[model samples]
Target: MAAAQGIYTWDSRSSSYSEIYARVRSWWELLPDGSNPLFVLVREFEATGVTAGSFAVLAEQFSRRSGTAQAVRCDLELAKVQEYPAPWDGLHVCTVTVQVVDESNNSRNAYAAPVTVMINCPPAVTAPTGRCAMVGFYATAERIVY
Candidate 1:
């Protein structure tokens, strides 16, 4: 199913759309693979009033908080499509549905921000796993080699 599969527009009001977790600079990875953890970032919006939910069950282990606005942390499990342990050789990627709530009434204009995560790939899973991105949307997924 496409990322934003179940989201619906009531045909009556504001706006909504979908987003990819990796697109968020704070959550992106240079490489795509199963060895590293992936974070799914979703943003929901409605008039200063409307709110709805019944999100796909695929998002396991999530934390929800609401105040001036609402935000959620999606749990994503990376698949091992690329090779591991080889610097510049293995690339890991994960995809998720963002379900952006649109009270502004624009849907087709929806777009994705694919986060390019740069990793220090090793030749193997190594005793020490690469540092995973922390929670929250990042300004940029810049690579910092130590």
Candidate 2:
């Protein structure tokens, strides 16, 4: 979907057959009303040319094929913009979550390896160039400690 939406995808692997598959199934429940928008539809894909292609390319193709694919339904709120305080005022907070039940695909109670997640959001982000660049002056004290 990132590729489809012209977003950045961090897919780096040898080219073989497409083995990367991703999906975002979400729902929203207003704190009070308990009503929110739905995904309308969601789907996961296993691309053939995925091995060599960047996630951007694969995601684009996946988005194109989103209509004719099977999707999974979810019961959690996603990307719900809630108001924050002061410095974070105008900027809304977008949150994504997942539930790992003892199901077939995601059933692992052990803690050896959790799960690597990929979130579906817009491409534009506040990415930092240097180490810990996204961190603000709050870390100045720690920096001085060094």
Q: After superposition, how far is residue 88 of candidate 1 from its true place, in Å?
A: 6.1
Q: What 10-residue stretch in candidate 2 is worst by lDDT? A: 131-140
Question: Model 2 clash pairs?
Answer: 4-60, 15-52, 18-48
lDDT of each: 0.28, 0.21
What lDDT is reached at residue 123 by model 2? 28
Q: Summarize candidate 2's per-residue lDDT along 17-93 as a digit string, tens digits.
A: 23223222211111222222232111111121123344455444432221111222211222212122212212122
Candidate 2 lDDT score relative to the true structure: 0.21
What total of clashing residue pairs does each candidate reach? 24, 3
Candidate 1 to truth, TM: 0.21
Off by over 4 Å in 1: 1-91, 105-130, 134-146
